[model samples]
Target chain A: MNLKAVYIHIGWFQMSVTNLIIVIGMVVLFGLALTLPFPGNSKGNKKGKGRK
Target chain B: MSIMQEKEMWTSKLRKSWQKTLPVEKLLPDTQPAYVASWIYLFGVATLASLGVIIASGIVLAFEGASWYHYSNVGHFINSMHFWSVQFFFVFMVVHLWGKFWMAAWRGRRLLTWITGAVAFVASIATAFTGYLIQTNFDSQWISYEAKDGFNSVGIGSRFNVTNFGQMILLHVAFLPIVLGVITMIHVLMVRAKGVVPPIDAFNAELGERK
Candidate 1:
């Protein structure tokens, strides 16, 4: 029942390190999902070239 | 009114309205627009899949009982599955919300879709909170003790007693899930009705403008 949680303290702001990691991971994943091109799309190049 | 026309009954009116609002063709589309290609689109389905796993594992746990789950190896595994699926569900759902927000998914009269999804997310948080309170462990005890004051400050502590294990269990397993499920179903149906909101670039292209 007395488990220790890793915490990151900066000045007055403090949060569990685990929660901080999860938030950072979500932001990174969202960035990757937005920018990374879907694979196996032969038509993408031909179709995308027409648009800006 | 023609003689052949049947009298206007509530059942027929409801059926006609349902059909008109969600035509069968739109309900089951064979293809999507060319611009539907995006990795972000997968998160919504991923969230739904995690919900399926959570429900399946939860049904097993409910059938086996909490004491059995706490002590039995198989029950422990199922419990872990239920727990992890919930984690995945929230992660995927939040990412889906992010994607929708950036794309301005409420465009083209799809405000209801956005509203329902937002409502479902709030309901899901309530459901998760109740799930935590019903864990029947020291952690749950600590959480309930801490959360009671917050609820009391909001004037709902008497009505929604987090310390009541039986009430928490019913809310987690039954009431909250029903609310979340109904809202989720409406959200998906609205998406189906409106189709995927086109990208902002597509909107600009149609208007002969650039952003």
Candidate 2:
């Protein structure tokens, strides 16, 4: 891969498309990790006993 | 205390502290409370997983030497992996840090865990800075030159010597990573010892008052 395919350019800073994609992908993944409810989420017994 | 009592005191105190703080079941719990299934809870493990990838890729890159990545495709690929892994690690860690902060995970006297994790985040940034400095490229040179004035003004430039390739490489590959790893281990152990913090709502409900 050409690591220098600049996708975003500021005055003295440049970000390659590849790196930008990776960062965007990570953000999406983090969003999903924070918002998505999984199967393990159950409103189980609310007993406060036996917890450490 | 008598001599025998004094001798027993050390061992007895050690064992007692260990048992009370981290019983076997708590250390290796098979079942977590349903609340643990929250997506935010997974970021801690995700950060760890990305760190693992970063370290593994770093080891491979180290064996090939620093400049080899510029010449060899495999080396470049591994280097890219390492770079991306570090990015992912930071992203996940920051999210986890924010999530825990919002949840007040430091509540319930897990202050040490929170402190260690925050320190680990700082150390990780330092490690990444050193890693960038050791890349042996124009970018590294520019970064080092740019960063030297900041360190010098802070009276740390002489000690850290960001421009020194050997020192930077050593810190990037060894010293900083070791410190980061140890802090991370302590953070995880504290989490295991203290158990996951309950949600703020649960905590407030348990206390019978809105906090």
Clashing pairs in 2: none
Local distance difference test, per candidate? 0.87, 0.88
Residue B55's C-alpha lDDT in candidate 1?
95
Query: For model 1, what is the error of residue B130's alpha carbon versus the real structure, in angstroms, after optimal superposition?
Result: 0.5
Estimate, for each residue in B1-211, the C-alpha lDDT of model 1 and write its tens digit.
7533543766777888888778887799676677787899999999999999999999998888766667889988998999889988998999999999999999999999999999999999999899888778888999999999999998899899999999999989899999999999999999987788987777686788977
Residue A16 in model 2: lDDT: 79
Error of 1 at B66 (Å): 2.4
Query: Candidate 1 lDDT (Cα, whole model)?
Result: 0.87
Strongest candidate by TM-score:
1
Cα displacement (Å) at residue B92, model 1 = 0.5
Q: What DockQ score does model 2 reach against the true complex?
A: 0.50
* Per-residue accuracy of model 2 over B79-146 as CA lDDT, tens digit each: 99998898889889988987888889999899999999999999999999999998888999999999
